[model samples]
Target: MAHEKVNRTKFLFKIIFIIIIIITILSFSTEILFIPTSNNITTPITVLPPSFNSSEEKFLTYLPHSGFHNQHDAFINAIMLSYLTNRTLIMPPILTNYYPPWSTFHSLYNALNKSVIAKKYRKEHCYIKNDGNGENIDNFCDNNKYSKYDNFTMLNWDQLFDLSELKKHVKMVDRGYDFSLDNLISDFNVGENDTYLFIEDKRFEFEFFDNDNSTRQIHEDFEKKFLISDLIKIDKKLLHFASLFHINRIVLENQHNIEFRHLIHNTLIINNSKLLNIANGIIKKLGDKGNYIGLHIRIGDGIYIDEAEDNKILIFNELMNYLLESGLLRNSKKFFKYNLKECVSHNLPIIYLATDANDPRKNLYKFYKNIPCVFTLMDFSKDLENFGNIPSDFDEDTNLKSFYVPIVDLLVTAYGNFFIGTPKSTFSMAAVEINNLYHGKNALVALP
Candidate 1:
């Protein structure tokens, strides 16, 4: 009888364990469970968290396009639109690209670092095959390693942002990846007739001012500014924006709205602790908070690339003038008196260079050679050994550590006491925002 009781207990325990697994699977009806394959590899699946509310409220959404910062801009605009209209927000997966520096950059890097023996010093080129049909093949690197990464990855919203913290100010939700009115309407979120799409010149961007009393003509390029208050009068169930990419897409002129925007920006901090911890470790390696000087230089593409030499000089000089004015240097004449070697000998402030120039040693080294103790993300690879923990967008098989370098640059360089970045580049703009946030300052932090 005693032996039979023990057997029964074991059998019950097994049944309970199986039931718990089933319940857990059912609850995560909207998340991805990584199932490992025979090779100990998992497929790269974009997890779009579903938060379909039963509440009969209107919704607002926009197509997320371009790189991370561009998508970030559109998201901010979408949430503001949702708030102003008092509607729920339907978010699409944030689109990311694995386009590394052009092939020439890699070619130059390999040539420049040929003497360097450390594996950590080597940069990863985009190994994912892409459709470069009918375009200048010279524009991209062809070192395909991961057949799955096609230059783009649809990342979940929470992967880049704290959706819960952001949703506190706005009612945001995601309905898989589709933004089609038909699909959303099918979900019973709204009717076709009840929806309103801001149909404008699809090729050009138009600004939508939030306040009725403000006359802020931000951009004149595709010239069209509409008031957000007018949309509220439509009384529709869903307000769809075809495109909202520009930083000033939704200009907040009202003082109250401006204040609220600041609050929202503060709350919309980078959500990943793993990334922050990695950043903190990098910061510690860089001598910690307020100890170093940060500089972000964007050489840009196309016409900007032609003007790279001139633009980089302008940015570098601006940084110099800034340092001189701030008394960081001994004297205006002695600025850059120490070469990198001498700077290290003298123990001058470390200069962290956050750039998109591909091969900085070849293309940009001459420009900043006079700086004391100049370093890039590659210089601190030992500290960034856990960058693998940094979530990437594409195939899990492909170690797209290169994809997060710019992001890591932003995080690490933001801690510098003196920070300056390229004007008008969204990447630079992000660096400034981050610098300010880390120091408990406003979003538009003062820069040189």
Candidate 2:
């Protein structure tokens, strides 16, 4: 009888233990469910600005007005967030439905291809209107196909930003010098908001003017009449609040310069644990046992200002040498720089992603000969299959949104936006900013 009683007691304890374990699992599942559910719940936006009592609070204004490329949106958002406490982002009015032109798409494909040479690749092959510009000029001429539509025109920088709807929200002040950096800062400060947003067409006010949609022609004519340094000077001056680069503006040309260095020093860093985890996950997936480094090289004509005469091969050599000497590449404590030699020696792999494929001039293998890397070109293009089903067309006046999941993930994971591209690209700048934010520091080193 005593033995039976002891067995019953043991059975009762087992049941209790099982119940407790089940309860713990249920609790954990509920917590996990709540997190994602809360993320999906959208907060209602209140348009009113926060009430302020201080009169000394100066507003910092950010002007990101032009709507040329979809990549510019990231830069626009970065500036808005950077100066969030004392700033407001005044978006330019949306213009016509715009998509990237054939030339631009062609350039993107070429850049991606060269970046990951000898890798598998594919892109969305769609029949966009070939209105006889650049490569399509011959196609249109051969068939006498210029007269598809008389009103089908490209959107100008100024035309892209109508601002009629936003006029009521903004008080217009004539900056005496017309888009001068100093004038932009003073006019937008309404005494309440510390950072105000005032934007205009830099090309029209300071760079070039175009009444017709002949920007390429206007750029050529303007270059003869002006200097790129003049625009660079204005950019240097305006680095205080934010400079929204459109039309291929993101790059590291001026990264080593004083002004950009100063900008980097002033910003704060916010690290995202999630981003770090994602990066670590990628490294493990690639079977990276030891050293890893990022080699960011951009190809295609669009990446350059005007395909400057410098041989890209020489540029690649210079960049590689810089990387070899940099501490990030030399030191194995925190970072392990991987190059062609190191990849061969250590059997390290590379994760290369590009925007284009059909370019001959880019020397892909010469720089990354022995490096093993992952290429998402094929898989990435596959996801874009259903993009055409969307009701909206790519609009030049407004920004066109693209989903580059693999590239974005790689960029974010590596914390590598600083060394990504040219100065005239918002895409590169935003990438750097995002990487910086992910790494939890404003001043990030893109070693080469």
Candidate 3:
């Protein structure tokens, strides 16, 4: 009878334990966040970002804007700030040129290839339109492409970078297109009662300069500096910022803090296996590593086109000076006279040009005139894939190739023995970071 009583007691304890475990899981699942969600997206965005186990832990997120490199800078800042504030970082989706802000990766790529936007991107298929200027452009989708509703996509953080690596430093929640507060509240039971802090900057590009003495440089450049102490002290469940990185927005003062930020920057490597696989293959085929020079010329956008000649001259002068001085060119005077095939016969130094300019050989012949051994991505066109599904009738997808080539260019350039880039170019700066990671002390990426 006593044995029966003991067994009944054990069974009751087991039931109670199971009930407690269920309650614990349910409680942890009710996470909360306050932010802007996508506008009229077709697919339902689920709040799958891991919730904080502890009540004290909050989150830090910001608006991701501009091109990929600029958005990358924002992500770096987001993680650093999240670590500083002892909060989980809610990383925003990577915004590609075709993609709207906060749109996920797959959605962005798929829309670019499958939707009406695909017609616009594959410029060859679209009927060519001429502005008053003689140049024919492929901008038919200029109106509908920007609509967050129509061409909606989001790039999960892990697609570009390794979250496992990021998680090593700070806690992070993968916010894959879950931009809506309504969805967040529904998924995690976020209540209106929850304290929310939103730091929206009225300035065009907000910057947080953290320094004890605001120097003349800061006085002239920044409108005003926000107090770090005030930011840290704010007791809000969700702390958000706006336009954090236009030009290295936050500057860490303390040695520990600065090192931490640097570590995160170093940690932010291009871990996407597909990118590396393509890049590594190129690097191997581009001849043995550290034997060639990588040059990135940006002449397609903004002031770059206007100053293309000057850029060309500066790059030419720098390369000539470097090659002659470094003894890389055995016969400097004769190097230009010989043809590329002949240069190959002589085993001259290889100079790979990564540029936005169309038909670089015809448009910018001067660069090749000086360095006959110059090679562009065109040299390896067959090896590199378009990465988009072109229609059976369409022979070439120039637009899809255009979208992918920049990243490939960046990666390939980063592995070069020497890299020369266009000044004030964020893509160049990003290449420098990757170069530093690979070459470290030997990194010699010069901006002209």
lDDT, candidate 3, residue 252? 56
Instruction: Name model 3 segments beyond 4 Å from true.
Output: 1-54, 100-152, 184-189, 193-205, 209-221, 330-345, 386-402, 442-448
Q: Judge candidate 2 at residue 155 and give its lDDT.
A: 25
Report the number of the highest-lDDT candidate: 1
> Using TM-score as the measure, which candidate wins?
3
For residues 1-448, what per-residue lDDT tens digits would candidate 1 score against the true structure? 9999999999999999999999998878534432211211121111232344434456777665446776777677777677666567788666554312212322422322221111111124432344543342443332233322233444567776776655645656675534344666777457558877666654355677776777556566557777777877877777776666776667766655565567566677776766777778878767777778888877857556777777788877887787678665543235466454555455576788887777877777764565546688877777678866434443343344555666788877777887887767777777778778778898764311
Give one digit per residue, the lDDT tens place, for model 3 in 1-448. Answer: 9999999999999999999999988766554432212223221222333445445556676666556777777787788677666667777666443443333433433443343344434353433433323222334434334233223334567766766655755777765554444454344334465545444434333345445554524433456566555567777767756545654466556566666666676676667665677677777766646767888888887789898888888877888887888788554777767654666577788787888888998877987766657777777776577344421112233223444567888888767888788887888887777777677742323211
lDDT of 2: 0.34
Assess the local accuracy of residue 92 in candidate 2 as a C-alpha lDDT between 0 and 100.
25
Of the two candidates 1 and 2, the one with more favorable lDDT, higher being better, is 1
Total clashing pairs for each candidate: 0, 37, 9
- Candidate 2 Cα outliers beyond 4 Å, as residue runs: 1-292, 302-311, 322-353, 357-363, 370-420, 443-448
Displacement of residue 238 (Cα, Å) in model 2 is 23
Model 2, position 195: C-alpha lDDT score: 32
Give per-residue CA lDDT, model 2, range 1-448, as digits (tens). 9999999999999999999999999988765542211111121111333322223222332333322334234333333222222223333222222222322222433332232221111112213443345654543221244232211222222222233332222212222212243344445444323332323323322222111222333232122322233322232212232333322222223322323323432342223333334444444443432333333334555645254334345445554564556532332432234433444455433343333334322445544342233232332343334333212122222222232233334443344322333344444444555555545655334421
| Per-prediction TM-score | 0.70, 0.36, 0.71
Model 3 CA lDDT for position 149: 25
Model 1, residue 248: C-alpha shift (Å): 1.7
Candidates' RMSD to native: 13.6, 21.0, 9.7
RMSD of 3: 9.7
